[model samples]
Target: MQTEKVTQHIINWLKNYALNARVNGFVVGVSGGVDSAVVSTLCAETGLEVLCLEMPIHQAASHVNRAQEHISQLKKRYKNVRDAKTDLTPVFEEFKTEVSLEGEQAIVDMALANTRARLRMTTLYYYAGLHKLLVAGTGNKVEDFGVGFYTKYGDGGVDLSPIADLMKSEVYKIGEYLKVPGSILKAAPTDGLFGDDRSDEDQIGASYPELEWAMQVYNEGKTEEDFTGRKQEVFKIYKRYNRANKHKMIPIPICEIPKNLK
Candidate 1:
């Protein structure tokens, strides 16, 4: 990818969207990952107001530190960039408790983690509504469509997806061009959703590079592959992820009315 050209292209898209929508600014939830860093920087480059929120729900200190560092750098570099930290742990705990109370069993890990994301989503849209800014999404091509790792209507909820077309590896390339902090640029990618500091790969079953390759093969209609060893297993895993998350990745099925009934 052409770093400079891609950078300018995204900036133009942001500006045009804001102008057409009559929104004065952008609201991005920064997770201290390459995707967020690159996207927030691109929004800042548009010379429009950018509100970056560091929302931690029982977050790790290291993740918080990286978020602070990235926001600090953006604030220094761009006058329009504004950032703040919000801890949603209490809210999430209460929400989880209420949900579990409805049922005898406690909330499951996946359900509990999804609540954290939806809370952050609510926070971002709150600021967006108050400030009249669009909610910018940080999802990349690989995770957005490859495995559907994001929670539906949670982190997946956004006004626009700037990097949704670019893969995770491509996001890193743009991060380098944008001078994103080395600490964050080199750090492993994580959603920072759960208490355990599990990297994206830890949950995805393969590295981003490997997943990207598998995604390419899947997209290319090249399904005939050996499924013997670890490498082949990775490809098969990718196919499973794609099939499972297809629902979240596509539009919800709607009931169609028959003309005769009408």
Candidate 2:
């Protein structure tokens, strides 16, 4: 589908969902990544009130700056766009202290990093409830379903998703068509979870493009055809991540009731 058509379809989808659910607007966490940028802009295009929130929890300065720039542009272009921000550093620090124990600093950091995402989720819900809006998620296809890179019940927890069907590259295409800032389009994608400031590529072991290719090949049932070099390397990486994150992508299992008992 063309970028414009896809964008319009998403806008219409969000509108119809809100109408059916009886919500007045959309509340989205603007993480300054391409997915969030595109999703927030699409929310604004629906002509409903959109609360674009910047909830930074000791996030990288560059990521926070990009988020602010995108929000400013949205506010200028769309009157319904509302810019809001809440710094979660203090909350994160307090949680860190509460979770701290001797000789477990690395474990503490790992748990706390995920806590940041959960905290952000809580903040978004607080604003959404106050404004009577649906929480719009920013995760794209590859991250949401393919690799499951998001924090479960964190960024993964949402009322609705606008760009979850599109791949990362497709999201960039829509973002460009929507006139996302040139700087943001060029900026490296990061989840802003780790304090080391690593990009998504650094954590994922393959670029988005590479991961997309691997997903396509896997879906095509070409996993058994082995090859050497980067293709083989990407295939391996994809399998590892996809398998490790399968739980996150799937629904929680439940025991089936016995027919006699039913």
Candidate 3:
């Protein structure tokens, strides 16, 4: 892909979108992941006000360090870029106290992880509203469309997605081009929702590259039965997630009223 052209295209698109919407700029939740790093950099390139919020809730030290490093570099490079760190750990703990943790252990743990994402989403939107900025999403094609690896009404909540069309590999390419912090580029891809070192591959059972290949083959009308061994396993994993999380990929369903009833 024309890397330079694509970079400029996304920057122009962001600038136009913000101008058309009459918003000052964008507010992105930087998670020290390639996706967010690329996105925040792209937003900064628009030369508009870019607010990078580091909202951590029991986040791993490596993740926090990488996030701060990227934000620091971004601010140094772009005069329009600024950052704010909001430690949501206390808020998260207080919330857990109010809610019943009654459920299967695994299920409860998953719910809490998603809660961390939702809290960050709320924080991003709060800043967006306060400063007349749009909430810029950092999701990529594989996570946003292929496997649905993000939380609905949480990380999935956003005013606009600048990188949703780009695959994970493509996101990394742009990250490299944008001079993203080396620490973030080298780190394992993770949601950082579980507050652990578990990577996204650990949760999905498939790496981004494997998922990207599966997404392509599946789109071209391939099925699990067509592949053998590990390919088949990856295909099945992709299909399972794509089917179960279809709700996140589609518009909210509405019950249509009958003509006579109206």
Candidate 4:
């Protein structure tokens, strides 16, 4: 994939985008995941002001530690990089108190998980506005396009996505090249939204490699019927998520009136 060339391309793209937009730099929500680590590092490479926000809401200890470690290393390596931590636990608790938690337990938990993401999104935009920075997205191809595994108006809310076109494996490759903290690079991927130890594989029922394979085969005009056993199961899982989360992958629906009606 011409790793060095790809890395320079993204860095130049980020630099040009920020310059064209007249923004100082970028603000990225670092979650200690490979995606965020790679993204934040790329933004730093642009040699512009990059703010990394660690907004945690009932986050797991391992996740928090990894996030801190990555941020620390980034700040040390890049003079333009700085970080801030906002403990959103109290804010989240207050929000829960104001809202009714009436519904199925699973549904309610899911909603709260999304709320955590939205809260971080809000915090990111707040800093972006204050610092004249663009909100840099950390989503990769599989999550952003293949599975739609992000919260709309939440983590999906961003001014620009630097890694959306790269697959998850590609992102890891970039992470390794960028020298991201070992703890983060070795950790299993999770959204950290549920405040649990469950990995993204647990939630999606498929690993990134499996999903990438399914995405490729599906895009190549292969159907679930063409596979059997585990492959079929993975394909079905990918298809289900793609269908269910199509709303996130496409433009919002708008009602268009007929000319006569107008």
User: What's the TM for model 2?
Assistant: 0.96
| Model 4 pairs whose backbones collide | none
**lDDT: worst 10-residue window of model 1:** 98-107
Can you give the TM-score per candidate against the true fold?
0.95, 0.96, 0.99, 0.99
Cα lDDT of candidate 2 equals: 0.89
How big is the positional error of residue 62 in model 1, measured in Å on the Cα after superposition? 0.7
| Candidate 3 weakest lDDT stretch, 10 residues | 56-65
Which ranges of candidate 3 are over 4 A from the true structure?
A: none
Q: Per-residue lDDT of 1-262 in model 4, one digit per residue for the tens?
A: 8889999999999999999999999999999899999999999999999999999898899998999999999999999999998999999999999999999999999999999999999999999999999999999999999999999999999999999999999998999999998888789999999887899999999999999999999999999999999999999999999999999999999999999997
**Stretches > 4 Å off in candidate 4:** none
lDDT of each: 0.89, 0.89, 0.95, 0.95
Candidate 2 lDDT by residue in tens digits, 31-110: 88888899899999989989999888878888888888999999999999987889888888887777545677777666
Give per-residue lDDT, candidate 2, residue 212.
Answer: 95
> Taking the tens digit of each residue's C-alpha lDDT, what string does model 3 give over 1-262?
8889999999999999999999999999999899999999999999999999999888899999999999999999999999998999999999999999998999999999999999999999999999999999999999999999999999999999999999999988999999998888889999999888999999999999999999999999998889999999999999999999999999999999999999
Residue-wise lDDT of candidate 1 within 82-194, one digit each (tens)? Answer: 99778898888778667654433335776777888899999999999999999999999988889898989898999999999998888999999999999998898898888
lDDT (C-alpha) at residue 66 in model 3 = 93
Clashes of each: 0, 0, 0, 0
